[model samples]
Target: MKSYKGRGVVLHTLKYGDSSLVAYLLTDVGGRRSYMVQGVRSRSGRGSKLALFQPMFPVEFEGLESSKQQMHRFREVRAAFPLQGLPFDVRKSTMALFMAEVLYRLVRESEPNEPLFDFVWGCVGALDAMQEGVANFHLWFLAHLSRFLGFCPGNDYVPGAWFDIREGLYTPVQPAHTGVMSRECSAILRDLMACDVRLLSDIGLNRSQRVEFLNAMLVYFGYHLDAISAVQSVRILREVF
Candidate 1:
């Protein structure tokens, strides 16, 4: 096996045996990779390492890789920074879960994507610092993430036009297929297309509006990426906000 060092965010983890676990990560060097970590669930001293695997936590790891193995080994893991709010805040935690799940399904590259990694890392920093407007954060995050995924739904708001989910663009008329968004929600998306994430707290939304736009963004995502059938964390997120 070859050794490499990189920074990554934990996306998902599943129990492997009684005390071991398998984790999926989006890393700066390896993109999306899985690692087998033993003793993460134990009452022994090794269990303390579990904190390094929280969703959306920025961490640096040294990895042992080989072509013959489907999962690699990561060691010497350390948190890049302490997240102030994401781990403690209920709404932000739910948002992190939903965003992580979306990324887990969408980010499939085994090669490096420097810009994409930077985007996720920066957004996580902003999410940890923000104290308000948590509801709109995920909406903006997905809107910007779509850009990196190559299906950026551009903001082309016509007076009576629809945002075509399948086309990943705007249209003057309703799309023939079921992949479309109304002008109102499309307007919100248009605003999000250029809004700075640091100002996510400034974006205002009622509960229903949040529900509608989030669903619209998911539909837009579903049209481009078939793997994302549903985002389960959204249910708890809706309740928190």
Candidate 2:
């Protein structure tokens, strides 16, 4: 077996028997991969190791890799970034769950993508430290994430242009298909594309507006990546934010 060392963000995990876990992670060295963590769920203090596998938690690990096996085994693991607010705060934790689910669904490749990995790694830290405009963080994340996913929407918003989600562009004529955003929603998306993380607090939206835009963005994402069509954590995120 080949030895590997890298940083990763936990996407999700599943119980394996009574003493092990199957953890899925997006790693800097190997995009998305699964690891069979042994004895992490045992009733002894080893169970505490499960904390390292929380949704979107960043960790550095040394592991053994094999050409014939899909699930690797970790030799050692530890937190890469100690988050200050994400674990204890309800809103941040909920957002982390949604983000993790989205990544798990959409980032299915096992090939290394350094740029994408860096973006997600930075966003995790950003979310943890963010104080204001936390409600809008996920929207910002999804919009920018599309850029890495290769389907970022065009920011050409004129007064009456509709956003053709299926085509990923702005247009003056209404799209015949139902996968289109109204001019109002299109403008909001345009703002999201231009807005920076530091300026999120300035972009204001009520709960209803936020939910509508999030749903619209999800529709746009679905057109490009079919796997993200039904994100389960979105409901809980909406209620919390």
Candidate 3:
């Protein structure tokens, strides 16, 4: 088997039997793939390796690729960069869970997408380094991620205009569909779409407003992608932020 080196963002992992793990990661070289890592769950020294597979953790790995196998094997795995804050901070950690779950559910491609990989990798670093806009970070992430997912919202906002979630644009005339966002929520969404990730601190939302906007954005996402309507971490995220 040919060994390949790659960087990836850990999306999810599950225990395999009692002493191993099956990890799903979105890689720079192979897009999304599952790796069957042996003995990571053991009570001895290998248990520490489990930390490397946490949600949204970025890692560099050497793996053996086999055309015949659905689940690949990792020769070695280690963190790509040390995260200063994400794992220790409760709020950021919760947001990481939400981000990871959303990515796992929506990104199913096996082929590599360099632009998307770079965007996600950069965002993971951004999230770790971020300090001021912690509350709005996930919303910022989702807004930017939509560009990669092919349904980035239109930023043309006018007074009294509603956002047509189904159409992915701002409309002066109210959309008859239930997927339309009210003027207030539309204005917020417009701001979210227009703001850069570095400027997330400038956009402020109260808890209710944040929840409402997140629900609206998820609805917008759900309209375009199947099975994204129910992200399990969303409820926990709402309570945390």
Candidate 4:
């Protein structure tokens, strides 16, 4: 067995039989890997501690030689970042679930992507530190995700030009009944692209505008990516925050 250690986030977790769990982890060094965690149902199990059910945890694992592509066995797992605030807040929890679902769907397993991994690690930290307006997390997350997925909004389009979601370019004519934001929406998006998660709460869109913008962004994602569903957390976020 070859052992490795690094920082990681729990992207998804599922029970295997009664006492064991299969966890999808996004590691800083290894990109994404699955680990078979034992005794997770027990209170004192290390699996319980190293799981992604909690945010911002450190992990150590050993890969088995029998199946090079199978889930690794975890040796040590612990929370590297103490989360005092994000878990307690409803908005933040909902937002976390949404992002987790998105990552679970999008991030590939066993690929080395340091930049995307670091972005997710930093995002979990920021979500923990957020004090107000947690709804803004989705905006920042989506914008950054676009950058990573190579569908980032373009800059060459004139202010009045329409955004072509399919082509990922700016156009003079909008498609019929397709996803298109207004000129004001484009300007706000440009502003959002320049800001980080912390700077988003004060970005100045009202509740409805935020919801509309979020819907448009999701549509933009669906236009580019396959099988991407409308995020469930969007409604909960609008209802609470």
Candidate 5:
């Protein structure tokens, strides 16, 4: 067994027996791994709260990685920091709910990617710090995530152009394929592609605009990744928005 120390974000979890859980985590050092966390329900099992394993929660852990087994065992763990605004704030909470599902489905690799890990950690922290204009953050995140997922959409959108989601580029005419963003939505896409993440709040989007853009991204991501069959939190995100 190899001893490991790393930071990670919880992506999903499943309850096991009565006092334990099976958690899927995206780690900075180990990439993706699942652990059977014990004593979470009982007060006697190391005092580690089950909330530490909730979706999108950032944590630091010490664990054992064994070559013979796929599921690793965590010896100890703690929250990376208090994400003050995410849990209590409804809009951010819904966004986090939607995003955690997306990442759980999209980020499947089990190899160390420090850059990807940093981006995930940073964005979660950003959401916690942000106080306004959260309406566009999810779309912004999806657009930027394409860079790491190997299909960064081109920013060459023109007045009459449609964005071919599968092509990840713009064209004067829509493609024969079903994957395309409308002219107005395409313009929004270009702006999002060009704008920095920190300045996403500066861009104004009404509720319809937000939903359309988010749906476009969902379709785009679904076209590219086979694992993302559906995003269940999308409707909830929209309803809460």
Candidate 6:
């Protein structure tokens, strides 16, 4: 068996039998892969080395060539970043789970996108390093992801123009559709596309406004993404914000 090593972001994990784990990870070189981990339920399973469900780990794996579609096997794994406060902090942890779920849904298997991978890894690092006002991480991430996913809405919303949600374009005519945002919401969304991740917290939105913005983004995704559903994490995010 040939073996390989790379930095990976853990997408999700499931209990395998009683003492093992099946972890889904997105590695920089290998793309997405599933690896079985053994003896994780032992008394020594509480620390950094086997942080299977958490993102941002450097993984060493053995390559099994029996099948082209074979699942990757991990020989070792460890955290690349010491997440001091993210797991313990409620808001940060919620953001991480929400983002993880989003990535798990969005990233396709065997798709090699170095730029997108780097972007996601950077977001994880930013989430860990964030000191305050990290509530807007998901919103910013969604907006940035839209750009990469090729669903970036037109930033040409006029003062009196309505957003064309299905078309992903801005127009002067009022939308015949119900999902389209109002002129004010359209303008706010235009601002979102230009803001940096840190500045996202400075957008000065009320809870209602934030919800509207999120809904608008989801509507855009629904038009673009085939299997994307309503994000369940939005409710938790709203409650937190």
Clash pairs detected, candidate 4: none
Displacement of the residue 32 alpha carbon in candidate 5, Å: 1.2
Per-residue lDDT of candidate 2, residues 1-241 (tens digit): 9998999999999999988899999999999999999888657574478889999999999989988988999988999978999999999999999999999999999999999999999999999999898999999999889999999876567877999988888999998989998887888888888987878999998998889998988889988888887689998978987
Compute the lDDT for candidate 3: 0.89
**Which candidate gets the maximum lDDT versus the true structure?**
2
Backbone-clash count (model 1): 0
Could you give candidate 4's per-residue lDDT for residues 169-193 as a string of tens digits?
A: 6666776656677666666677777
**lDDT per residue as tens, model 1, 22-115:** 9899999979999998777777665467887888889988988889988998767789898889999877888899889889988899999999
Worst 10 contiguous positions by lDDT, candidate 2: 39-48
Better of 1 and 3 by lDDT: 3
Q: Rate the local accuracy (lDDT) of all candidates.
A: 0.85, 0.91, 0.89, 0.71, 0.85, 0.71
Give a tens-digit lDDT track for model 3, residues 35-57. Answer: 99988866766447888999999
Root mean square deviation (Cα) for candidate 5: 1.9
**Local error of candidate 1 at residue 168 (angstroms):** 2.4
Given candidate 1, what's the lDDT at residue 146?
87
lDDT of 6 by residue, 16-47 (tens): 89777888777777677777777777776564
Residue lDDT tens for model 5, 155-234: 56678799998778899988998889988888898888888777887898898988888888888888889766666888
Q: Regarding lDDT, does 3 or 4 come out ahead?
A: 3
The per-prediction tally of clashing pairs is 0, 0, 0, 0, 0, 0
TM-score of each: 0.92, 0.95, 0.95, 0.86, 0.93, 0.86
lDDT at position 172, candidate 5? 93
